[model samples]
Target: MGREIYFGQQELTLKLTGITRFFAIRRKVTMPYSTIKEVLVSDFEAPKWMIRAPGTSIAPLNIYEGSFNYGDEWYFLSFERKEPVVIITLEGHSKYRYVVFAMDNPTKTAAEIRRHLHEVV
Candidate 1:
């Protein structure tokens, strides 16, 4: 197994294991960097349906979820897979409604977790 990489909150210390085959994921939904603005961060939790995404079919999702409020912004973390499947959820208000920035881009280095936050925040 390769070194674990994450796309969500570091305080949660979420880790993924079966990403040995992760490089094959498509490009539209995969990248090394992205960014969302005016994130709400809270409100959305780890959705149960995510276990069905592109990842291990036998192991249940081990994503960790948490939320923190900063000023009027709420930051939510749905710690999805560690490599091939970490869920980085960024909540933001769009057109006067709440939206979840769930278009996560894998392939990032382990040291690039901050870039993930930048993609979502």
Candidate 2:
């Protein structure tokens, strides 16, 4: 299944659906727009060395969903294919330093998030 991104009045939400929700062990993640540091759309490959603290990963299929820990940084990833994705960097976030997910329109998604970030500022 795919993921959904929602922009709220003061926060951005990433909602994981279907089997993704089960594998990710999270239904949704919310962060205040003020916490967004950067947003970009790019091709991403999950580091093979990263540890999955509580998430699902299928390396062969490039399916990764849930929380991952690399060094001291925490990341929330949700992607089924190795395509372009929206990577959002955050500051003052309690759990994740990065939130990377696939969207139907990555460029548009990133732009929308950026607009929200600017508005919050």
Give one clash count per candidate, in the order shown.
13, 0
Report the lDDT tens digits of candidate 1 across residue range 1-121: 3323334442212332334234212111222233332323232343443323232322255443333343444433333454343334433322111122222443333225545555555
List lDDT for all candidates, in order: 0.33, 0.90
Error of 2 at 60 (Å): 1.8
Position 30, candidate 1: lDDT: 20
RMSD of each: 11.5, 1.1
Ten contiguous residues minimizing lDDT sum, candidate 2:
1-10
lDDT of 1: 0.33
- Reference-based TM-score of each model: 0.24, 0.94
TM-score of candidate 2 on Cα atoms, chains taken together:
0.94
